[model samples]
Target: MLTPESAAKFQEFTQAAMGRQTQVLINNSVVTEPWIRTPITANRIRNYCN
Candidate 1:
């Protein structure tokens, strides 16, 4: 589930990365380059929100 904050962050990240000429690597992988990524969980968000 994409909450408002998470959705916003993702949108912002996508926009910024798209605008940049250089590639952005997250966790040793290029974000723009497609690759399998772990699914987001409420557990991660809960720990953060609480």
Candidate 2:
């Protein structure tokens, strides 16, 4: 779960990057490049477990 502060920051980032291609990185390695479809305005949690 994201703290309110973190979620707000993420929302700002998404708003700025909306409709743009971005890279997902982990440990200084590029994971995947994907286009941002929309801005995430809600504080809803997302499950990244797979």
Candidate 3:
């Protein structure tokens, strides 16, 4: 069982997390370069096995 104080802190934490997610989605969005995301070739995977 949580004390009242602990429950209030938990609620505040969730609110802060939600605020950050909203900022990311609405403002400067995060993205990655498509060229850098190219699929790995078979040889590359083989090299890692060596």
Candidate scoring better on TM-score of 2 and 3: 2
**RMSD for each of the candidates:** 10.1, 2.9, 17.5
- What is the C-alpha local distance difference test score of each model? 0.48, 0.78, 0.36
Candidate 3: lDDT over CA atoms?
0.36
Better of 1 and 2 by lDDT: 2
What digit string (tens of lDDT, one per residue) describes model 3 on residues 1-50? 44566656645544555523221122566332122232322221121211
User: Can you give the lDDT of residue 35 in candidate 1?
Assistant: 26
Worst 10 residues of 2 by lDDT: 41-50
Candidate 1 residue runs with Cα over 4 Å from true position: 19-32, 35-50
- lDDT tens readout by residue for model 2, 1-50: 67899889988988999999887677999767767788877787453535
Expressed as tens digits, the lDDT of each residue in 1-50 for candidate 1 is 56778866765555555534444475987655332133333322222211
Clashing pairs in 3: none
TM-score of 1: 0.37
Score every model by TM-score: 0.37, 0.66, 0.34
Candidate 1 vs candidate 3: the TM-score winner is 1
Which candidate achieves the best lDDT against the true structure?
Answer: 2
TM-score: the better of candidates 1 and 2:
2
Candidate 1 backbone overlaps, count: 0
